[model samples]
Target chain A: MTATLTQLIPLTPPANPQLQDIRTQAAAYLQEETIPTNKNEEWRFTNLAPLLAQTFAAPNQQLPPVNINGLVIPEAPDSRLVFVNGIYAAEYSSIANLPAGVFVGNLAAATDAGLTVTNYLGKQPGGEEVFTAINTAGINDAAVVWLTKDSSYESPIQLLFIATVDDAAVAIQPRTLIVMEAGSSATLVQEYLHTSIPNHPYFSNSVTEIWLGDTAMLNHTRIQDEDITAIHIGKTAVSQSQHSSYTGNSIDLGSKLSRHNWEIFQIGAQTETNLNGLAMVNGEQESDTHSVIALTKPHGVTNQLHKCIVDDRAHAIFNGKVFVPQAAQQTNAGQLNRNLLLSPTARIDTKPQLEITADNVKCSHGATVSQLEDDEIFYLQSRGLDVETAKILLINAFAVEIIDRIPVASVREKLAVAVKAFKAS
Target chain B: MINPNSPVILSIENLTANVDDTQILNGLNLEIKAGEIHAIMGPNGSGKSTLSKVLAGHPAYTVTGGKVTYKGENLFDLEPQDRARSGVFLAFQYPLEIPGVSNLDFLRVAYNSRQKHLGLEELDVFDFDELVQAKLDIVKMNPAFLSRSVNEGFSGGEKKRNEILQMAILQPSLAILDETDSGLDIDALKIVANGVNQLSNKDNSMLVITHYQRLLDYIIPDFVHVMANGQILTSGGKELALELEAKGYDWVTEPQPVG
Candidate 1:
């Protein structure tokens, strides 16, 4: 690692002793790790040169005055957690009316509640990865969500992360750890956003780890809509127990360059997982999504659909892996990556990998990259729609399949509007 | 319904077209006046579908020769969408299942486009809903289908009914039915044909292209034309459809001795 990049890693002692051990271990591991480049197989299609060349300072301590008029989700009016540049903003948060057996707070509040988060925090596999290690080593505070055994939270919990760069390029590592106990159920909406500022750039590295216990269910919706000048890299690691259900809907809309690594591991039998993701990019932006679903037990079921709409000269890359070992006999897994290139220069690289060792398992994977169909366009034209409107309608149709699955009504409507307004140019 | 005094709605003279380097329409000639219903019957590979596609301005088909005039104006002057907005409609044999586009939305947009082209005020959601509901009874379609994707997961009969419903909504001057009865059952054909019959008037015209005399039973036409090798070979009354059905296409397509 370059000395300049190494100097950016924060080694400040955590205020709470509970994080000292993990921080030290992660910091030691960070020394041996370096920022990944195109040489890395996982990052072959994503060039990190821009991110590596620019220097990033620590997050600003003084929060900026902002207007979040439209950033709030109505469904979670009283259960929202707001963070600015990775630091918890208590004044902007509303934590009232939460049900019993639920704890939603920052790391300091968790310590006060006598919550033992270390048992599940940073415990998911892939903690040794470079960016993950960097986030772990620099952990000062995190958004923590904990649901006790058999607890049910009817309303969705919102975690909003906002970033701003007024002067220098700042870097922030936002951490989220969600633990759902046995038979518990809850819905979560995590959003990463930034103001519409041009030329001013920032870097955001985020890590989220979720644990679902036996018979638990979780509905997770993650949205990344930062400014076009920002660089973002995020990881979401999930572990599912027996009979647990996990459904994730992720949308990537804004960023100059971004990479998202989503990994899921089924540790027990009869687990169910459904993942749907859409990455819509334009301009000269680049977006990469890498996902892995590893099944270790029998009778596991997983279905994944990841789509990308590349417009202008933007580029999109998707690599989805599904592993079904011998122990995962009778596993049913389906993975499909569908991409739409709106312009001649727009590019999409998709790879669907299925490693099946069990003969009895039913697993299927496929990838398709296509532009608009002439027949479809002509069909719409025959119905009185002009060529431009027909293309927009078809593009919206391609995205609505994933957007409609979002559980939150406001989010779905907002995304639908954005998708409708998108143009190829 | 034929009226000699009525203005000519469509006139096709020696229209030659090709799709993917293969000539599909070979100097085809046809003319239809307002308030008239014409039925064109032909055997397989006779360019029946190609003629409709060319009239609708499908991009894959290139016009190599001849010209088509609609409402006394050259039809080729307008784009496909403009042709549709100007009252030319084609009911596809295989309706596309456009997933994620609601039937109601598609109908509203299409109806509004035609309304705008006619310099009429566009209907809002509420008003369009009321109008579409009244039109739904024409085809006896369930209102639940309006909320679903356009033609998606619809049965063959439902798709044909949907096409007829579109024709009823558009109220086109020159409506072309391109094998509309190809995938329908006996019951579906009756319902679809009944819808088309209800929409027919002295101000509009229809060109029904079919392979069977069965659809003609429900939608009786003023003129019936037999087509061969991409051109119309004979023109007769409605009984011509019955003769073709009974005697088969062999009698018409067979080479006659020099006479």
Candidate 2:
């Protein structure tokens, strides 16, 4: 593990002095930290033995040629930044449609804006975690979006990461930083995908940090659709200021084994946070989602709904935590986790926790694990649909509740098709 | 609408059924001619709903004995969906609330299945929408219901109206109303009955199952039967429904002196 960590850090330091300092500190932190095992409480349901057994080298900087037409979302055609193997691909990126005071480009480009980014780069909490530290230790470039005060972009801005693996196993660490100044608003879509048809095994470790200023609103959508043979571990950390609103939508559908860590902290009062997540796994795939919502001030509002559909021998795990301390009076929070098992052998472990110390707060949480109801299937069958069609309709209905909330039209249509194709193996 | 010359549309001979190891239907016998509406009045636990479910091929009920023929074909031989496509319709007492499935799409798919069974070309979205809009007027349903999920969050009156709207679209040869008027008010009952009356024709038959006689004032059945212990205790003209209403369920279950 030590040898693999050394190979991930680039020998040549970045030109930006601020990033160089971050890298050196992250390297020293890694000497004391190690990869987490199943014995850890946070990773009890997720075994990383498959990931730790193999050694992975950093991907080369050379960009491979591939068709990206299918990955395009027509709603955000002109404001897109494409990254290949954690490196920015300039030939495929377009920023002609962005308005003034909106910066959409790589970290190197954000460095030219003079110290505006340094205040938020690698500044979010939870940087000491092993995977996040690994990403910071090898941080060379990142996808950065900086919205100035009172600047609003009408269309969505897309950040797409494509991983292409060759014969040898490789590791790629992707980083993203989004900063919304006071009264600024924008819609952002972040997607991760693999280009290889029969993909070679690879590891993708990624970290994303978002900061919302006072009264700012941001709609964020994250999609992870790596290859079936890959391993993906991701972290999304968010900080919201006074009266700011943040909505996040996450869809996970790929990887043989994957885990997502979502954390949200309310730094000011009267902030609102909404989160929706869906994970669909079949065959031998395993997926886990761990989320934490912390409210420190009064009058904060938060709602979270996460669902999973497991089929065949697949497994899914979910652990969600919501904290309302003594200072957070009059806070309203709700959390729910719903899971569907399509096969008898499919497994789901869901735990929803609420820690409330404030007497004046309203909080509720529940978790449900269920199979397709016989009554539902018979109801559809009685309306002239066969059993197979009935099963598909019910499954699609279960998933459409989350998919329909997506703001993008083409993305919703694409996911609807993928959901309809789900069948028990 | 009953005529002696019309052929028998449905015939049930000593039908026996069970649900969850308990017998619900015990040797029930009935026959209906074409263009006739027959009303069955019974007390609770008399297997009135079970009879409808068994006829619709619900998975929970198993037919332990006897036989039922629909238009000269064995009803139990076909699967539930095939039976539906072959002109059998059951308006449930409690319609299912399927979230996220649009009402218009569900109607179109069910209608297309019947059309396909009859060897007719299927209608596209525009034509089907036009047809469904015309049918919606029969039940006095608002066009907004088409966009909402099927029966989800609908009031009792709205759900019953939606069921009648489906009946207007399917136009089945044999329709079974399993306590359709259970939860509806008088106004909604009239609307549902009006929709059913419009769909009734010389080639179709209906079996209306209910506990009250108020629904009969609007529907006006050609025949009424008193059911007790899963068997037809007595059969008579439409006046039987009024008599049952006046005498209550005790008159049917009591042992009367020979007369």
Candidate 3:
């Protein structure tokens, strides 16, 4: 550690006895650790020097009652939670008639006796990485979702975090913790939307921790479409028990510099994990995704596909690692990373790693980085589409491979339009 | 309307082209009148496929010296897509697989482009489905293939039939089949050839490029040209296919006395 992040940025912890231990741990780690540099293997392709140079402080202002009627996903969820500037804003939230056992509220407002937020509040399955430690130490309010055993919800739950503008560079940390007990199921749509705040470089440091018990299934969709001038560093830590299934669709379409880290672990046998990620970047923006899936038990199945479409002078990076320990016999794992470059200056760096200690497992990993095939464009052109139209069609085709996997129909349509508009520009 | 003395629809004079810095078409000359089917048969690597791609304005091929006239217009002056919109279609031997673009959507887009070119009304989804259902009879394909990605995961025979399906939808005046019978079985060959036969008319001409005489047995070409070393060595009638198949391609490449 070169320069301690805690000493550089002063954050005053709120007075909460239940969260005192977590706050103390976050502060200690932030003081002990320094910001990661390009020399770090995980930060090699992405340079954090520019972001580190900028001074960021939490935006201090009245929590704006931002109207999110236009920002919410189409066919809005029955239960919606909205947060502005990392603080819960109930004025802009709407909760449908949830079941009796399911509890959804802000972390700061939940009482110690009502909802237990101390155990899993800042504690993630993947220990505190550098940025996550910073976010945990700094964030005062967060969204806490808990579903008791045998509880199920048919309609998807929506969580929206809107970033309000400020005059100076501001750092906002929004934390989310979801706990699903055994034999429960739920669909979650977590989104981050940024308003066009002129001249303000917003830095959003967010963390999501999900724990699924035996026979539980959680469908998670995380989308980050912040302002182009913003910087976002998000983490999702997931742990699944026996016979549990976790499906994640992580998408990034905004921000000048963004990094998403997904850490998944199987604690019991016969668990299933499916992960699909799409990073569509243009201009000088950069998006990087690093996912690690560990199978600690037998009969585990994991399938992951990550795709990145880079245009202009942008860059994208993907690093996927699958670990199958000796105990994880008869494991089946597949990982594929594909990248498409639309310009000569665009770049992609992908690394898919598989560490297998069990000879009885079946695991495969592959990565490919290429521009659109000239033959494909010619093929479309020969069918009477002009050059520009043909290029757009092919570009859409490249994205559809990953977009089609998303379970939400409206979200898929929204992304399809964004892809077409990007091509036009 | 039954005029045997039809005007020439496509005339190629000294059509020389190169692909990947290697000359593939060397001063190739051919003239096709309206309502005529010309079949060019040669052994492998005889520039037969190159001729088909060059005519479709493939971006990779460079035309060094050639004058191609389609309907009295300089074909080189038109873009590849413009050429397609102007009623020229190429049935590819190896149809590229597009993973996400549905076959129905692709055909609709292509059909609309041609319809707009002629100032005709474009068909909506329902109307287009009705129109395409009628054209499916040309190849006897299952309607399920229409929803799948274009030629993706299709068998060799299905891909060729898809080409015929596109041909039926576009209804081009000059259609070029590039080795459409290469990997087809007997039943598939009959279906493909029958589709071509049904789509042929006095106003449109066909250029079938194949290696086997079996396909010619079904389509029955009017003129058979033997291409060797990037140039046509001889031209004859339908019987010429049988002669070439019996004597083998060696006769076309054998040494000949200089005039």
Q: Write the per-residue lDDT of candidate 2 for residues A1-425, one digit (tens) a residue.
A: 36666777777777676788788888889988778888899999998877877878888878877678889788887789999989899888888667888889998888886537778878888788888889998898999999999999988999999988878888989999999999999999899898975668889999999999999999998999899999999999999999999999999998988999999999999999999999999998999999999999999999999999999999999999999999999999999999999999999989898999999998999998888888887877777888888888878888898888888888889888888777744
Write model 3 residue lDDT over A189-230, tens digit each, in one string: 899887756557888888998989999999998999988889
DockQ of each: 0.79, 0.69, 0.76
TM-score of each: 0.94, 0.95, 0.95
Q: lDDT by residue for model 1 over B228-247, one digit each (tens)? A: 89999999999999999999
lDDT, model 2, position A282: 95
Instruction: Predict model 1's lDDT versus the native.
Output: 0.91
The global Cα lDDT (0 to 1) of model 3 is: 0.86
Over the stretch A90-129, how does candidate 1's per-residue lDDT look in tens digits?
8778886677798888888877888888888888998999
lDDT of model 1 at position B183: 79
lDDT of 2 by residue, B1-259 (tens): 8799999989999999999999999999999999999999999988889999999999999999999999999999989999889888999999999888899988998889888888998999999999998888899999999999999999999999998898888888899998989899889999999989988898999999998899999898999988888888899999999998998989888887689
> Judged by DockQ cut-offs, is candidate 3 incorrect, acceptable, medium or high?
medium
Judging by lDDT, tell me the better candidate of 1 and 2. 1
Q: Fraction of native Cα contacts kept in each candidate?
A: 0.79, 0.62, 0.79
What DockQ score does model 2 reach against the true complex? 0.69
